[model samples]
Target: MSRRLLPVAVLVALVAALTASSSPAAPRQRPRAPSGLAFYRPPARLLAGRHGSVIWSRPARGTLRLAGAKRALVVLYRSRSLTGTPIAVSGTVWVPKGRPPKRGWPIISWAHGTTGVGDPCAPSRDSPTSLAHGYIDYVYPELSAWLKAGYAVIQTDYQGLGTAGPHPYLIGVSEGRGVDDIVRAARELVPALGRRFAIAGHSQGGQASLFAASIARGWVPELKLVGDASYAPASHIADQIKLVGAFTAPSPISALGAEVLYGAAAGSPAVSISALMAPPALALMPQLEVKCEPQLIQPDSFGGLAPNRLLASGANLGPLLALTGRQNPAVSIPVPILLAQGGADATVPKPFTDQLAGELRAKHDRLDYRVYPGITHGQIPAAAQPVFMRWVAQRFGRR
Candidate 1:
């Protein structure tokens, strides 16, 4: 390493870590290696080919009084990695009273959407501006409702968020692996949350739920999934990127996300980011991507990533659009698959979700898809929880 450039690289790495730590688009964190103890390690493929099976654990339990319910957050987790490197994975299992509930509990895998680096970005800071305006976003309201219904809520932090290692972005296998590990952990924790779990999530989480349901059929012989309910999942990342990427308007947030994706891709051997793009685009990434607060993000920052980069990545829409089969079909499910979308969502296009559901119906079993006429991305789950809760009850055959 060049002595003159060493300080600058260190500064950049520090700034990147701090910048990522914050963000209206905040993320979670893990224990960093000791200060001044630096050794470069490349990204490894941790969760692959039946990934979660290799990293299952006994459960971790904690108690917290929340929303008038004496709920215990049982974490179904594992700290081992499929990559041969140690990685931590965990989920918050909110078990209602009666220490696992007498009649046992139906599993509700509470999936969360994208938050950039897969880490819990910022806590409840004084959102005075938005709070004053009476706005509440991403609180996982289902936790309260599911608890009241005597269902155990298993919310996964996924692999990268809070757990150690570089987040494998949009990689269903890894996320799904994390989901499977947690579910297995949950079943052992209470012993009542056995098989036949109902999966639910929004955006990125929705996608993960699909992957989990698909894998439960094979990898997790013990787990029986009855339904998969996804809300505006990024079923088509390539297309969604194209849809959002159309906002020719310049936005730093967009650039940063693209930058991260590129970095992850650059960092990912499954899909090469550098091989997909030419020099200037690849070279301009560092300069174009970074932002201090990430207050506003749009489509433009993702320019060099789209049209070609996404297509070349081999996961482009072409295959996802025409997907069908048992492992992880692109469409709905063989069992009950409920897909709800907010028509006004600016992020994951509702039309794309509709198309995905339509494709799934051709070879899928039971499926229900609803599009809230005027709702936006954030409002979809809030509006449909009543119906979702009932659907979940039905899936578990809850009388």
Candidate 2:
């Protein structure tokens, strides 16, 4: 399915609204927490247990009606780091209102888009009026629809987003493991959930979904992964770095480039930050540690600097590029895949996803690729929602 190009004026308004909402001048409200900060900290001994084991959980707080979920929970589960170290991960589980099927409620493990690399940026930490709510408001309704359809939705905060460690950011292995392990954690907490599941994500999560599809069978053999869906997924990182390095003007998207570098450094000791970023970029590094995407994209932050200014004059991007290349989801995926792209997406350009879809096709992977003309990155999820919902239903034999 595809959409005809929208008017340029409409496109501009969409982008402007997104930018305005995330800008520094936006109204501020203290975000509500499902659990206290202490809940995120698990005992060292708990980390020694098998991956996906639930450490602890608490009933979800806030407006459950907004999500249309009957019961909600915030949980701390075990997962592995990029380097194979046992780590604790935080996430939320939302069960549908109706009675479960005799088999059980099918699971959808949701991997979210870029929310910055800081602990406070974790989506599990979002309340109705929180800083992240702008994007969440758009995405949660789709989740609520899935709940109404009787699918149990489990969203991972990934490794370190709300836990005690440097978030591996776009590091696929770490992100993918967190995506898959959370399903295990959810099922363990609620036995009413079935073993059959699908993985889905947008932007950064989109890339994570493909990575999870590639590794789910081997990583968590106990669970059955039926399909994967990606909405304007991030890909071709090496190419993006080269493109950003040539920029002569400030770009809000440059924050993502910085994130890629930071994530690479966090996931691997071999990737040196000092070698990858210039003094100018290094000076702003402290902000990446605490600020989420909205704050990071402000004019005074990463958005204020031209992409070229963020890197060293003769930076050695080999290590970072190689690590990210390994993360690209262009390779063969074992299950059927749904790949969506927006023609006007400025963040992950249409060509990047085109290249990725082409690669997947060449590999003979089961792929359903759709393009929505004039849709921006932020709009692709809603634009492609109906198609993906049906696709996911087919995967689970729903109707």
Clashes of each: 10, 0
Model 1: residues >4 Å from true position, as ranges?
A: 1-65, 74-76, 79-87, 99-103, 118-137, 241-245, 251-270, 274-332
Specify the highest-lDDT model's number: 2
Candidate 1 global Cα RMSD: 15.9
lDDT of each: 0.55, 0.84
lDDT of 1: 0.55
- Model 2 CA deviation exceeding 4 Å by range: 1-35, 63-66
lDDT of 1 by residue, 59-130 (tens): 232222334244454232443343544455655666666565444566777676665442332111113342
Best by TM-score: 2
Question: What would the per-residue lDDT of candidate 2 be over residues 219-293, giving only the tens digit for each residue?
Answer: 887678899999999998877887775688988877887888888888889898888788888888889877888
lDDT of 2: 0.84
What's the residue-level lDDT of 22 in candidate 2?
Answer: 24
Q: What TM-score should be assigned to candidate 2? A: 0.89
